[model samples]
Target: MGVFEVKGGRELKGEITPQGAKNEALQVLNAVLLTPEKVTISNIPNIRDVNKLIDLLKSLGVKIEQLNDDTYTFQADEIDIEYLTTPEFKEKGGGLRGSIMIVGPLLARFGKGYIPKPGGDKIGRRRLDTHFEGLQKLGANFEYDSNTNFYKTEAAKLKGTYMLLDEASVTGTANIVMAASMAKGKTTIYNAACEPYLQQLCNMLVNMGAKISGIGSNLLTIEGVKELHGTEHRCLPDMIEIGSFIGMAAMTNSEITIKDVHYDQLGMIPQVFSRLGITIVRRDDDLIIPKQNHYEIDQFIDGSILTVSDAPWPGFTPDLLSIVLVVATQAKGSVLVHQKMFESRLFFVDKLIDMGAQIILCDPHRATVIGLDKQVPLRGISMTSPDIRAGVALLIAALSAEGTSHIHNIEQIDRGYQYIDKRLQALGARIKRID
Candidate 1:
């Protein structure tokens, strides 16, 4: 609903701190709903989606108090169960994809979970079958209302059992793990998602007295406890934002230091970017990208064009593919960006093409970007953000462009990033938010 008027070709140089992991915050905030005691969390990003989830929790009668600028305590001692059946609950909860996570904590604590069909970026087919099917495996009766697209679950007693997930679905795995934490018996989950977000969730559960093992492995074993307690947890820094900053630095020929990246949890993200010929150096915990006059894509050992694709854990995240693709435009070589997870994310290349970048959209899943080698500067043009990751990619493109650029529908950008314009301004980039 707003626009960013950005003056392109500014070489930003400064230290920018990454916000707390948005994905992890979504799961962790919902975990507070599992206990009646006060749960305090720090480093929460002040973004739209997170604020909406907090609002949704508040509407359910969860007592929330702000402890600091980026810290809060939540107490879900008295939830209004009757509100779950209301139209407002369905409409408001459905607006956020993270809201589906509330179902897990609700089911564990209250023995009933009512969830509206959640909404998120329209990147690809993000099915909720993993969530419902995993919950059903834990002895919950699943019922779906076709007209309303609401999922209602109930259980007299949730008894745990061994189960193998269809995939390592992050949210699905988190949901099932939360449900199993309060079940009657031991639960063993194979093919679980072991992302840092899930590990942090498991650690938080353990802090709250839930018995869980295999913290960073796909196979996990959980022994259900009778109850959970309040705990304090801190979220890891946002890796996606750090990766975006690396891409932004490369495209604009800028030197930047991404501070306190939690390098251990990054898990091959830096290496993946290095594969694109971007010069990256690590100074203690921070990742530094120096301004490069020219960088070339690396070929495979067998002498084939490099393919950048996303995989499960221990692989490059699918979320950063857009940034990777955009930064490749100004590099010194050609690389194929294979967006294996989402089909529609690659469609944003048309906007970059209009900006004079030579990119070939091979299909919905693949695009070959021939780097300009900084020979011709991209011209800034008007564009609308299609999704969160693509929006940042466009912002990076606009910053590297030759003239002023106007980016509309910047709300998509705001949903994921926290005070992005102010942060850019601090880095000496000229960007104004037009309301």
Candidate 2:
């Protein structure tokens, strides 16, 4: 674990670029396992989770070549199937939640896949029922071992069929799609997640010779193919990172431009922030959040309290609600942040509350944040990050606080973000990394 000693109240000024989408990159990287040819992927985020998946693939005897700083070519000509059921895979695979995704590609190409219990942020009960359920509908026999907590799937030849997912789980949808692409007959996944990350995965698969329709919609149709070929894919800019930077700019009262955010793709994020009275100017594909002395929270048309909650795609994402809650600290008036997805995500407000922000945790899923309105800056304190998004939210709060704040357990932060301290330093913020 490491600590970030953040000296807050600095006016940051610069243009920053968001890294490649981490979620999309995870799915894309695992898709390379479906083909034996060389698959080149660009704009891959150099974060811990992505690196861990790459390392796991390397252990399976896949040929990997780093093309550049943010690109790599992976060829899965040979794989060690025996390695999947070993204790070492249990240890290494448990290191990341994305490890479960590798099972999809493995099953698609090898007719069998095994994944030990995967690990990730402990924000809530993130279930893998959707993943196994969908793959099961595709003619895969899935069994869970209670003792070792591993999921093993085997199928001689997968025959696709119709499936309506219980929830539009993003990773679950991606997993099923990768598996279904090589199955026999047609696969129809209704209520599937249609986020840009999933769309990017589908697009890349289409380029690799998979037949898929409904690129940006919830219902996806896939006609199984015998085999897939090599393809090049570039991950889009990280929308979550872009939103985090925007929140940081607002919290620190800085003028910042998040370059090439792919604004056309951000469904409701810009407008959602605008509701907090944060003026976001769109310049082509960039988003500029100017430093402001004061901004007022917008009430509902009924003059009711403003409530910013999370929903499925085309709605505000649950990932950005934490950033929105933190950014609301210095805005005028109050707003209710209903996380909806995870129960423990809003609990991070306790750290912000300790920093002197007026926030009330109404329940496991709701928090009411009263804006400080720049009347008083938050005072720094020592805290630990509980999860990935919360870690970034706390960092933003610390960077805008009145004094030096210590944030420990930043390994959670490192898993998702790439070189966060260096990126903040480039924006003229005062932050140091210490062990």
Residue runs of model 1 more than 4 Å from their true location after superposition: none
For model 1, the local distance difference test gives 0.93
> How far out, in Å, is residue 284 in model 1?
1.4
Candidates' C-alpha lDDT: 0.93, 0.93
Give stretches of model 2 more than 4 Å off: none
In candidate 2, what are the lDDT values of residues 1-435, reduced to their tens digit? 799999998999999999999999989999999999999999999999999999999988799999889999999999998998778888999999999999889999999999988999888888899999999999899999999798999999889899999999999999999999999999999999999999999999999999999989999999999999999999999999988987888888899999999998888988888899988999988889998878889999999999999887978899999999999989999999999999888888889999999998999999999999989999999999999999999999999999999999999999999999999899999999999
Candidates in order, TM-scores: namely 0.99, 0.99
Model 1: which ten-residue window has the lowest total lDDT? 291-300
Per-residue lDDT of 339-428 in model 1, one digit per residue for the tens? 988889999999999999999999999999999988999999999999999999999999999999999999999989999999999999
- Clashes per candidate, residues 3 or more apart or on different chains: 0, 0
Residue pair clashes in candidate 1: none
